[model samples]
Target: MAHDPITAVVPAFNESETIASVVAYLIRAPEVNEVIVVDNNSVDNTASVASTAGARVVTETRQGMGHAFKAGVAAAQNDWVMKVDADLERFGPRLVSCLANARAPGIGLVKGAWQDPGDDMPMTRLLVQPAVAALCPALAELTAPNSGIYLMDRSRIAHTELRGNYAVDLDAMLRMAWAGHGVAEVDIGQIENDRRSPAHYSAMAHEIMGFFLDCARASSKASST
Candidate 1:
C-alpha cells in the first residue's frame, strides 16, 4: 500500500550548532514531504539557521518539548507525523524505513529506540524505564515506552493527551495503548551524539519520575471506575 506523505516535526532549543545538519538529513529522506522546526524560545540562532537551511520555522512561546511538539503538530500538513530530535547529526536514511514498517495496517503509533553511543545510560532512567514497564501495562504494551522518535497517525492525536512536560512521550504511549491502538518500536541505529551531562540527566530523571507518579495516580483513579 502507498504510504501517506510524512511531515517531520523537529523541536529545538539552543540547537543552533546542529539544527541545520539535522534538517539537511531529514530533507534527504524520500518519504518526508515537509520539515517543520518548532523553536522553543531558544536564546541562540536556532530559528535563523533552520530557516537558512530551508526548513519552515515556527516559534512556540511555551518552553518545553511538549509545547514545541504541540505547535509543530498543529502546523503539520501531512497525514502522518514523525518527531525527531534536532541534535542528531546523521539520522540514518533507514530510520524512516523502520518507522514506515511499523505503520503496517492497524498500527497507530511507532516509537524509535536509541542505541546508546558509548554513553552510560543513566541509572535513574534505567530504573524508571523498567519501573514504568512493570507498573503501567498500558505503556509497557510498547517495546520501548520512552523513545523520543515517534511516527504517529494524525487521526490518533485527537485521542492522545500530551502532558506539558518531559513525560509527554510516556504519557502518549500509555494513552495509545489504553485506546486499544497498536503501538510498536523500530530499532533505529545508534545516534552518534554527545550524551547529556550527569546534571542534565538528573534533571531529566526527576522530570520523568514526576510524570510517572502523576500517571500512576491517574491510572489508579481510572481503575476504580
Candidate 2:
C-alpha cells in the first residue's frame, strides 16, 4: 500500500483558520497524491485557503459531516481515501504513514484511535463506545469508534449507505466489517481541536445518540428474524 497513491479527504465548514495548514501538512506526505477539501457550504474562506494550500476544493451542500465525507470519497482519484478533518486536530502527514504501515497487515479499513492514556473523556467512557458495543459488538473493535480520522479502501465502502450526519463513522465501521472487509485501528496520538459551542456540542450528541438507537433497533430486528 505504500506504493499506492493516497488521497486525503478533508471536510470543512467555516474552517478558514486551519484549513490551509491542514492541506499543507497533508500535501507534505509522500504517500498522499492528492489533498481534497470538501467544503460544506462554508461562509468563510475555507475553499479558497484550501485551494491555495495545494488542495482541490469541492463542495457538499447537504450540510453534514457524513455528506461532506461522501462527497470527498466520491471525488477521490486514489484507491485509498484518507479522511481528515479541517480543524487540524488529531491528524497530520504522519497519519498517512501510519495508514500505509497498517496496510501491510492486509487491512482494508484503518481507523485512527485517539490515544488518551488518562482515559478521561466522558464521550468514550460514558457514552459512545459503551453504547456501540452494546448495540453492535463487532464494531467495538475500535476504541475511538466515532473518530473522524480514518483511511478506507474506496471500493470496500463505496456501496455502503452512509448516514447523513454524526453517525457516519460508526455506521461505516459496522458496514465495512459486515461486508467482510478487514478493519484495523491505529493510535493517532493526542489531538488539539477548536472548541465548539455548548449548543453545537449538544446537537452533535443528540444526532449521534439517535443514530445508535436506530442501529439498535435494526440489529434487534435482524436477529429476531
Candidate 3:
C-alpha cells in the first residue's frame, strides 16, 4: 500500500510557553506535511507563537480538549491526522514520526505509547486499563490508551461516535475497534510533562470512570437482547 502524507494538529489552550517547540517538532518531522494549531480560547499568545513557528493557526470556541481536537481535525487538509498536546516538552525524535512509521495498510488508528517520567498517568494504570480489558479485549495490550498523542485517519471516522470529553482518547480507540478498523500502538519513548494538581486528576478520574461505566451498562444491555 502507498503511504499518505499526514496533517499534524495541535490542540492548545494558553500553552504559549511550549507551543512553539511542539509546532516546530511537528513541522520538522519527516512524516508531517502540514502543522495546524487549534487555539481553544487561549488568553495567551499561543496562536501567534504557533504561526511564527510555521504552523497554520485556527481557533475553537469550545472549552474541552475533545472539542479542540475535533475542530483541528476538521480543518486538516490531509486524510491522515496526527494530534498531540502543546504543553509537553519533547526531546527525542518526533513521536509523530514514530507513529507514522508504525502505520500499516489496514491500520486506521496509531496510538502513541510513552513512559511518563513522573508516573503521572495513574488513571490509565488503574481505571482505563481494566475497563478496556473488559470492553475491548483486543485493545487490552495498549499501555497508554489515555495518551494525548496519536495519529488517525480521518476517513475511517465517518460512522464512529466520538466523545467530546477527556475520555475521548479511549472513546476513539474503542469506537474504531468496534468499527472493525485495525488499531496499532507504538512506543514513542519517554515524555516529560509538568505535574498537575490533585484536583485536576480528581476531575479526570471522575469523567473517565463515568464514561467507562456507561459503556459497561450499554454493553450489558446489548448482550441481554
Candidate 4:
C-alpha cells in the first residue's frame, strides 16, 4: 500500500497520565492525519486528558481492548489505520517507515515486532509466544502472532470479525488470513513498556491458550470438511 493519511487508533483504560504523550507524538508525525483514542469505560479522566491533547475521543462502554479498537476503527476517517498502545512514550517516527516497508503487495495487515533484545519480556510471554508461533498455523495461520501493533488498510475492517476481550488481535489476524489477505511483520525498534505483573501474566497466558485451542479446533473441523 502507498502512503496515505493514517488514523492512529489508541485504546486506553485508566491511561490519563500517558495518553497525552502518546497522542502528542502521533499527531506530530507527518504521515499520521489523526489520532483517535477510544476510552474503554475508564473510571479515571482518560477522555478528558485525551481531549485536552487534541485527540478525537470515542467512548466504548464495554471494557475490552477489542471493543475499544472496533469503535476507534469505525470512527476513523482516514484511509489507513495504525493501532498503538497509549503507554508507549518513546515510539519513534521510524515506526511509520517500518510499517510502510512491511506492506507487501496485496497485504492489508502489517505488524511491528519489538526489536530490543535486552528489553525485559515477561517469562510467561517468552514461553507462551513460542507456543503461539508453533500453534498459529493450525490455529490462526499467523506468524508473529503476539505482535500488538498493527497497520492496516481501512477497507479490510469491514471484513474483519473481531471477538471481544484479549482474543481480539488473534481473532482479527485469523480472519484476515482466512479471507486471503496478506500479513507481514516489520522491526519497530525496542519499546520500553511496563511489564505485566506475574498474576496478570498468568491470566493472559490462560486467555491466550484458550483462544488458540478454540482456533485450532475450528481450523481442524474446517479442514476435515
Q: Which one wins by lDDT: 2 or 4?
A: 2
TM-scores for all candidates: the values are 0.90, 0.90, 0.94, 0.87
Which residue ranges in model 2 land beyond 4 Å of their true spot? 89-93, 116-119, 158-160
Candidate with best lDDT: 3
Worst 10 residues of 3 by lDDT: 157-166
Best by TM-score: 3
- Compared to the true structure, candidate 1 yields what TM-score? 0.90
| Candidate 1 Cα RMSD after full superposition onto the native fold (Å) | 2.1
Tens digits of per-residue lDDT, candidate 2, 49-78, equal: 999899999999999998998888888898
Summed backbone clashes in each candidate are 0, 0, 0, 0
Q: Write the per-residue lDDT of candidate 4 for residues 1-225, one digit (tens) a residue.
A: 466778999999999999999888888887788999999989999999999998999999988877888888889897578888987866666876778667767787887877544454554256446655555554333335666788887686562357666777766666666677777777787777775667976776677778778877877899899
When 2 and 4 are scored with TM-score, the better candidate is: 2
Error of 1 at 137 (Å): 2.6
- The regions of model 4 sitting more than 4 angstroms off are 116-143, 157-160
When 1 and 2 are scored with lDDT, the better candidate is 2
Kindly provide the TM-score of model 4 when superposed on the true structure, using C-alpha atoms: 0.87
Residue pairs clashing, model 4: none
Candidate 2 C-alpha error for residue 95, in Å: 2.2
- CA lDDT, every prediction? 0.79, 0.81, 0.84, 0.76
**What's the alpha carbon RMSD for model 3?**
1.6
